[model samples]
Target: MPNIQFFALAESVCKKLNLPPIPFPVRKGRDEIIFNPQGVALDLLLDELEQYLIEKPEEKIFYKDAFSRLAAIEGIRLGEEGFHDHAAHYFELGLALDPANLALRSNYALSLQSAGRKEEAMRQYRFLLQQPVISGQCLVLIPAARLFLDCGDPVTAHQIVKHCASFMPVDNEFWDLFAEARQRCGIKRWMAPRQKQQEIMRQATAPDYKSAPTGKKKNFCPACGNRLKPGARFCGGCGHAL
Candidate 1:
């Protein structure tokens, strides 16, 4: 159980690290949970905690939980205050203790993006996307697609969403972003029927199907090689109506 001494120790640690005063949430009849601190460099603080844990090896689990939680809370606070670099630092501290914490990784990626570290942010997003737990969920994929869109790579964003959007459950947010990406990639609008959009995307992504050379005209639908009736507006084979 934490007490006044541990709280004082954490405050001193904060002072030593040149950070702002963190209000340690003291739970009644429980441990004094000291906030790791926001708005400061936490590398030193983490190092200190590590060294302390080394000396008192038996208390590792307790200290790790408390400190990692503290890091997340303070890191989020720092991010809210527009200190994105510091926030990222705190998130890294938390991740050191809980490497599999998706929340910390997500926040860390956002912090990196806000700090103008776009490449690092993309890397983090990719890592999240690769995790089995994400399972192509828009929670990570949409943000990653947005990053590509923001980077003037709408084609990539379109590519990311188009393939997955076909199979995933419909989400308004995902569709909205999908439409924005599609528009940037030269699609006229997102209000088109889902089937129509898929057809367009299929054509857009499909390999080039050349028409007859010279004066001759192709006699079939390029998408599925279905024989086309003259003046037909859609393909009967694969519904390749544009």
Candidate 2:
């Protein structure tokens, strides 16, 4: 999809990088803007767009836009380099300029989490949850829930997942997290009260044969749901560890 926000971001990035702007056909009526992605790849375009913005004497509105884009780009790069505090600084500046930028907000929240600023990250995630445009997005919802869980607020995480259930797909990872949240939050009502009581009675009365003793419970990778081998530190499928 051609995201208008990202299109403007690309233009702003080009300005900050002092690179020639992508050519667009000039429209006479209603200023219709068209973009073609056949020639240059988006990643390559963004790679060329990375730079720090320097203010000039005769700065215009475009300069501020470029500054915000540059800040966002640099913030992401710095965050990847493990300089999360510095990344957050740039993300804050970018968000101050364009408060409605969802991508920048997401990056800001991630930077805060990476910097061990848990409360700040949660605050940003709450703000994002209130935004209609971002609330239903998986990118925002998944991380927000994970952050809530990390903050020892599994109830909030479960609530977030419940609110987004209709729109979000039922993924194994989400279900795994939901199960953990429910367990941690002490939510035992998985069925009707009468049915739960009946099931409990059935289990109590059922004759059980002791099976062979099982060893330690198996662990699965949270990212990919692959069965973790004994003593393995990382997931074989996705490379993420528990």
Candidate 3:
């Protein structure tokens, strides 16, 4: 299974945040497997390549260039469209090329979580959070905390957000998760100032933030009118694709 390969490669390197095995493991006689560049446009690939190289300069010398990152993007797009298995396949293909790609690994975990493979998803999250790099990265940490909440372990989530909250910008995306974590820990007596601060942060950062009348939701859900979380790709209330 790719899961075993993923974890094995991760363990071999002692779980560094960015370094997976250089020239990732492949089946015998397939070391020469060339990545075919198709599906995504070349211009888009090049554009993303420039951004990726800037963000992850360590990957500049890797084989196949930006194709692996492209594959990761495609995988995420597929997952958002409800084709999860296909998404996993794309992520696996991307990881095979660039095993160190954090985006590929984290999105793979998310796809697994969306498919109801929570344990497998947590395995990936555990590997990710072990690295200090992930602690300050809102993209990975928030989702991992959300997964912890979904698994009914808000205490862990609260701990994660608590540490991150100290250093992360107050106006950023961590507050909602922080609030949810606090609520889950049965901390009902929130200070008014903190509540006001959370609301201010939400208004400042939320893409869909809006005020609505009584009996109406600020965010719409087809299956249920649960207020959507910022940056959520799916509805939390009914598991509906957003």
Candidate 4:
């Protein structure tokens, strides 16, 4: 996966060290639209970042900020062209930066959803909604709602939309989605329920007739009601070897 945003932590460290800013989602052999952070500068920054982490374990905010920025870059990449590599990398950074940050977690969930990792993304959303801090912000709420809808869990989607009801206006996209959410919620009820499939029994023996005194008689296997031989070691009609 090619991430468009390079490590902002690395970029920040390099900038402080008076090095060139390396952008992310490195496109090899193409014109460097973003900064590249692979050579000596990258090495130095990585070493420094590790050392910094060791030296000051309390600077959680700084690390979190770096990750949040990286996640934002991922969201941008998703909007631009729905690139999973860039999206997933940024999401990892965001979660790594601040695991407690529901916003970051939510964003990462959306990234995973866009990347076709529905269950993983749904897990993240469920975790995020469990937190007492979840609110109706579009960035967080919209994607969460979308994920629920996509998962055939429209009930949850409706709850999310209703929770954000105050935030919606007449022309807002949420209003349309709210309606969709309702429709999705009731979709199963309106549609005819699917019938259960019964197992088909295979024939144990082929059809055969027996010559009885009064009339022709038939002996069939109980499993498939197929014809069978009387007192034979095997069923010649259907090859049911006794």
* TM-score top scorer: 2
Runs with alpha carbons beyond 4 Å of true place in candidate 3: 1-67, 167-176, 186-188, 192-242
Order the candidate numbers by lDDT, best to worst. Answer: 1, 2, 3, 4
Cα lDDT of model 3 by residue, 1-242, tens digit: 23211112235332432333333323332222321233223223333444445566666666353457557666877898998877887777677667777778888888888788889889888888877777777767777888898799999898887777777546535677787789989987443346788899988887865566577346767688887887788998888998
Would you estimate the TM-scores of all the predictions? Answer: 0.51, 0.53, 0.49, 0.48
Query: Model 2: per-residue lDDT, tens digit, 1-242?
Result: 12212334366656656544533222232122233444323333333232212222243244456556667777878899999998998889777667878888899998898799999999999988888887668767877888899789998998887766666464667766666777778987444334567899999999889898999787888888889888898898988955
lDDT by residue for model 4 (56-78), tens: 56755555454355455445555
Please list all clashing residue pairs in model 3, or write none if there are none: none
TM-score, cand. 3: 0.49
Between the candidate structures 2 and 4, which one is better when assessed by TM-score? 2
RMSD of 2: 23.8
Clashing pairs in 1: none
Compute the lDDT for candidate 3.
0.66
Candidate with the greatest lDDT versus the true structure: 1
Per-candidate count of clashing residue pairs (backbone under 3 Å):
0, 0, 0, 7
Name the lDDT value of residue 5 in candidate 1: 24
- Using TM-score as the yardstick, the better of models 1 and 4 is 1
